[model samples]
Target chain A: MSPGGEALSRILYVEDDHDVRKVATFALKAVGGFVVEPCESGQQALEKAAGFAPQLLLLDVMMPGMDGPTTLERLRALPAIAGVPAIFMTAKVQPQEVSRYRALGTLDVISKPFDPMTLSATVRAIWAGRDD
Target chain B: MTELMGAEAEMRDALRRLRADGVQRLGERVRELSAGWAALQPRRPWDDADRARLGELAASAHRLAGAGGTFGFPALSKAAAPLELLLLGLRDTPAPGGDRLRQAGAQVAAVAAAWEAGPAGAEEDGADPGQASPAEHGEPIFLFAEAEEQAMLSAVIANLGYSVRRASEREVLEGALPEGPLSAAVIDDAVPDPLAVCARLAGRCPLILLAEDSSFENRLAAARAGVEALVAKPLEVNELADWLDHFAGGRAETRYTIVIVDDDRLLAAAYAMALRQAGMQVTSVSDPAQAIEVIAATAPDLILMDLQMPGIDGIELARVIRQTRRHLSLPILFLSAEQDTERQILARRLGGDDFIPKPVDLDRLVTLVRLRAERARALRAVMESDSLTGLLNHARFKERLGLELERARRHGTTLSLVIFDLDHFKSVNDTHGHLVGDRVIRGLARSLQKRLRRTDVIGRYGGEEFAALMIGTGPEEARGIIDHLRERFAAASFETEGGSFGVTFSAGIAGNAPGGAGPEGGAEAEAMISAADAALYAAKRAGRNRVMVAPA
Candidate 1:
């Protein structure tokens, strides 16, 4: 996927809810036309992170086991996941929460109750400005 | 393209099915919340197990809030938010209470009520990924305070007709996206390192420092923190509301009316379109013969007249308009190819406010019209205030009613017109001198100013009748406010040279919201005034000194 490096092609997505993961898969794969690895828990993400290298990280902030930030921390230990741009999606969009996520090395926080229709485009937008 | 369409269609189909599932899930959550509220012990000490159970309930509410919000049921989501917050607060503390707990039940009931209200604007946006969200959930006002203060402050802001999103206690935000596009932020002065925190938050939103004393040092520090406004700690709601309104920006601009009097139909149409697009109500007079009639009917803020015409020139027409005392100060800009310096000078000397060359740029024309009309409206506002009450005089009051009604129609907001006639004022003058009656009127005016917001328009409609225009206020709310005013007025005793005398005035309120059906028969200000007048008549018939709402 990185051979044509100019275009973003893969995303590592971790969310706790099955329904949300399904919707996200459709949005990121079918609509966005990008390869996606949708993990139901941060533990699953840790297990798969090294094998399925991704250009971006899309993680749900609140999860059943090992929430988004902790998951991202663990993922950074994997050699394949180094310096990958990450985004947090959560209903906790208070300014402090956004800042906390940013300080944790995420690109930005996508407010939960996010329009799934715009999810793909939002992902691409974050990836487009990665260098900035 | 075919493949793309196929995939898109499948996506839409999937979204439709998911939305249905989301609705069912939401219904389940509402039931779960109701059950959770029912399970709560009002007076019992909350144990760890109880707290955990309540935490699950809060989680349910949080899920419902997020799902409802995303599934196009914002009202339900908004109603669920407070419940979730309340539960969070309760779960954190051991103190058990009945009232706030009951209030949590009430919040659940509201969520159920909103869910019963059903989904609005759901189907259309199914396939339209880029469809803008309905402004039903306008950018909420962020209450950046401790959890203790947040609930109280959130209630206050919500009562002002704005939705509220609050920060958890001990929240520290250094960079962007606090509550997602905050209309304004209220900073608790007790927050440690408050000044530095505010400085970090400066450009994110308009920061309002809620402080005990606006001492010079604090004020200086506040300025450095880029606080746009301040509210004294003793939190006067009216002052807080006023500051919030000031910072909310987009305070519904003055929609100035313009009269375009041109002989050439095409040029007149062009000017009218330009001005109308720029939000000025434009009246085009292609036949300059009826210019006065149109201008009088429109009562325009400014006139754009053509300098050259076959029968009468722009200067000639303006000369005629200036002859009328009422139209004397009305700004008139003349459009003419007759660019002779002498003609321009002549036009300026005789009632012409400005000279526009024949081919005027539409953008420049719009800017000029806006600037001129704004000045005219300001001047007119001064000229329009009643000498006796410092409210708008009858004619100007009527004009503003029309303007405000137009605005209400445009913005889909609410407007209420109140007509107050002092009961048996002739008798008051007979009993006490006319000076006493005048004092009575002045007294009522002061009472109105005291009770109503500064944004509300008050006018001396007649010698003894007063009118008030309330913007963005619904009928029931208007009635409540005015009824309170009516009580205050009746209670007030005006002390004169001889003795103090009490007076009472009857008030009738008529209000309209876009798509709202009521006694405001026609959306026109004339109809509203008459409706209010009829209600006032009914009040007088029933017996005086009562506030009556116009009936549907």
Candidate 2:
């Protein structure tokens, strides 16, 4: 297998439980060979402004404590991140809500229970299509 | 190499164990502190001595806060926040300067002590959060850094039923010095430069600064900065709380002084007591000869004058007052045991606002005094208001017009003037009674008031004539509004004792003219009014009940 250097370019992964930080950790490091940071709260991801800081920031918008909009405000405060794209991974993403999230400063939001097999490749394609 | 690696791994494991143990201990300490703090409640019946003892108690609590969090007892440190703030405040403002501080300390201490006594204290002092009103607890706090310190302070104060917040560094001085309803602020003088902080905070809030040592210069500077006082550090929290309580409490009700110009000593004293009970400041003067001196000095809101006194009768005194010109509008209530209606009417004609019969009903007398005082304030407002048409009077109008003209000229806009007069108003007063004439004038004023926009001002210019200022309105719109008013006045009817009769008025509208327009069109607003007046006179001459438009 090709050194997996190209596979490390983008990542899309989801886990509802915070206790399993190691599961996403192994997938990012060994399988996808992607740089990854694990977070317990959607609030932390927004605070970090991963969208502007890196090539991608996969979000679980319906996390406990601070919900999506609040995280969005914190992310928006970062001036460098203007229109740096975002995507929400939710278990219940209706087509209407997907458009709503897209309207709310997101490029695309994927439905949850996404196949781990194709996750990294799918995320890479999405990133490649981004104008920014 | 393998042996060295094993040693490094063992050292790392040891460090992890220490961190874990430290976190657990911190969590336990926080729980204990929270439990201890939740027990605090304010207690009553605290004397001055109890308030003074609060300083020592606060010092101990301050030490606890400084040590508890550092020792991994975050909860205990957190619990000490309000106590630390209170203690620091008390320590900085000891003795006579913070008498209220002592009372507040006594209350906090009593509650804290009661809480320490366990379940019984909790049952007795348990705060019904629902019962606690925002008024007592809405003491705003300025946020500062030191998350644990702020949290502890907020918790302790919150338990005491005060709303608390972390003050920003920039706002710390302002937070310490409250402008409006704040009782007091516990200010730390150790921040970078203490004197500068004191000066900034003192500008707004009454600052009770934490003094490290007794320096006379520091005290003098604090006083100059409007700081209430400085209490040396190693604080007594209770005494500071007491000081906050007193100053933060409602101010005493306002008292009015009534100087009685009656000569009977017993009666004067009786009236004085009655007025005092009615919450007024009373000065009794039995000698009418000293009336002017007493009146000028005391300046009571109302004067109760005794008619048929030993030296001067009430009517003559009333006339003297009217003659003073300064006291022309002063309400003089005549106190006459004299039971004659003719005398009462004569007293009123002589400028007595009211007549209190002999054997005055204490209640009626009190009611009359309050009524007169209120009316006096109203009259003062009215003296600045136009008397005839109930708009701003001439003096106020001139000031407003000048200001408006300056603003309009600055912005390069037009200000217009309109002058109105009743056509043959002299005939109305002459043919009909003056009462009927007054009704017609009032009717015209009401009609103008309703037809014009709210921004327009209408003031009676002497008798049967009025003036109006229309801001930002051009000559066309001003004339349109004036014409509408004239038409409305022509259609309106005035009711008199005899019968109702139709009334009419003539108006002239003029706008701000260019500098070289004419003598009548100069930049001076008076020119505009005069130009409008000229057109108004022309309208009257031309015919009755018509609009006369002046050239811009």
Candidate 3:
């Protein structure tokens, strides 16, 4: 189940780093069996959001030009990804900072230096625990 | 259990295949990141550009730290985490000092070297992945030589995977300089009048000269021609290719200092650990009374202080710091658990730049500190740096000289100064207009800034004149460095309306060498300056574009 209490299949992951995006895509696809569409930046996420019609948004927090929280805010303005839950991935997440991410309407904050092995499982847990 | 064991085995095999395919590329990425980090190293005091670059480095390192751990290089991740933290803290503030930057750079270098070494079995045969292939990043190497020579060299360069662009000396001189950024340039010394061609391209890219003769005269000519490396002909193609690869791979790095003050030892340690992990040189003071002394000694770019202490509170401490003329503009950030709006407002009024509540979120704290520190640094740059050349201004230069001189005397170390004045600078201004003159000055400033070691203090002492304070350097070593720079400047061509022209400077070195008469106080600084000036006159009298050392 998705964080929105729906079956999560398609994930729109927005991360600027090419390597991180590649590894995350491998985890979600090969391990979790989810269809993952990756965007390099917030602007790219917006341009591809509607066409891809992703069920979840996995956004990196510290990106050049436009960051994750700003991306989510812009995406919320659009009808396509509006109310679609996002989970922020950032090295900056302290416990209080995680609360700030949650207040931004994200499903949760996944601190960076994350284990690739359990990443897919962690996302699934967050999905299952989502109130909506 | 048997079925599960079989499934786990299958997964392990798949993971191994993935790693084998991916690790090489990941290693390359790490090297690229390291090079980028190196390129961002601040040559001077932190400015707007340096701050922006710091932010970029932090963001990139943050990504690497996360991805590196996930991909089985836990060591790489561990190495990058501190860099990320350090950059985040330094992103907004002026860098702390050169020593701090060096420490941070060493940390990054360690990580980069580790990645280049790679993990056992990650590679097919333990070959250094960095040397495996030339970067296929679409950047082309420009070859400036005769037609026949170009044919032989282009093939070797191209074989290494770099795109090669060929141009003859005549083509380059006729204003057919390549349109894009070049990876490197190869020039055959047989070309007629190659100095002019080489001079134009000197600092633009790395230039390697292929010479038929290795005679002293021929090598001297090549040096005068502004090429970085001169190859005696019958060029070993493999060696040339390796040199090209090495030239293409260089990048930058920098470090910052932070001072953390809190009455709670454990809390102070926590903050210090976080900052240090980011590769920052951190000084923590748990006793409020010691804060002033530590701050004075460190002269840190940012002060992270807790609000409440036994003897003196953060607000009062900040006020005391502000009262001191030297640190009046220093950024003071309060990290406290106090939630009272009135008290926070009072702290702000007493010169607190920012306030973070207690049990501070480490990430947020770092970001906040960096922003505040960077802003303070940029403001300092405006007051401290010359508007035209971006070096230290005359006043700041003298001020810093006094400080360095005093420090050298206390430590019983040598301090050398080089005073340089451009030759025929007035004529250039008259003939080519002031704009071109300004360009020449700026070019020389950039050259000196780039070429000198980070410890050297450079300043625009006067119009068409510059001075550098080489700490821990004697007169002879200072002269050698100055002479090298003179040669480089003489080979550099400045663009003018009349076409490009070369400019050179005459320099004089004066130092308080060991067992020599040294400056006793600020008054004697003027005498030392005069000595250098006298030697400079001697250089101009003997010949322009040369260096002279003051007699003991």
For residue B371, what is the lDDT in candidate 1?
Answer: 92
Instruction: Please write out the lDDT profile of model 3 over residues B85-122, one tens digit for every residue.
Output: 66655554453643345445655675686576555344
Residue B106, model 1: lDDT of 59
* Over 4 Å off, model 2: A1-132, B1-380, B514-523
Candidate 1 local Cα displacement, residue B164, angstroms:
3.8
In model 3, where do residues sit more than 4 Å from their true spots?
A1-132, B1-256, B272-281, B287-298, B310-312, B339-346, B495-497, B513-519
After TM-score superposition, the amount by which residue A65's alpha carbon in candidate 3 deviates from its true location, in angstroms, is: 44
- Give lDDT: candidate 3, residue B59: 62
Query: Which segments of candidate 1 are over 4 A away from where they belong?
Result: A1-132, B1-140, B163-165, B168-176, B179-183, B249-251, B263-299, B309-312, B316-326, B361-367, B386-457, B460-552
Q: State each model's C-alpha RMSD to the native.
A: 25.5, 29.7, 21.7
DockQ of 2: 0.01
lDDT of 2 by residue, B1-552 (tens): 999788657644653354345335434433443443333224223345544445445544433333232223322332343444444454344332232344334334433442343222232221210111223334443323234444654563453334444455555544343222233455556555666666665534456666676589878887886668676654333334334433332222134568898875544554554465345777888889888878877756789988878768888887887786557778888777778999899989998899876555444677899899778857766776666556667666665566566656766777777777888788888888787777666666655665667767667776887777788888788877778767766775654546666767888877775432433222466776677888888888888688777865
**TM-score: the better of candidates 1 and 2:** 1
Ranking of all candidate structures by their TM-score, best first: 3, 1, 2
lDDT, residue B383, model 2: 78
lDDT of 3 by residue, A1-132 (tens): 234557778999998877667767877887777999999999999999999988899999988899999999998898988978899998654546678988898887776656556578667766866783
Better of 2 and 3 by TM-score: 3
Instruction: Provide the lowest-lDDT 10-residue window in model 3 chain B.
Output: B125-134
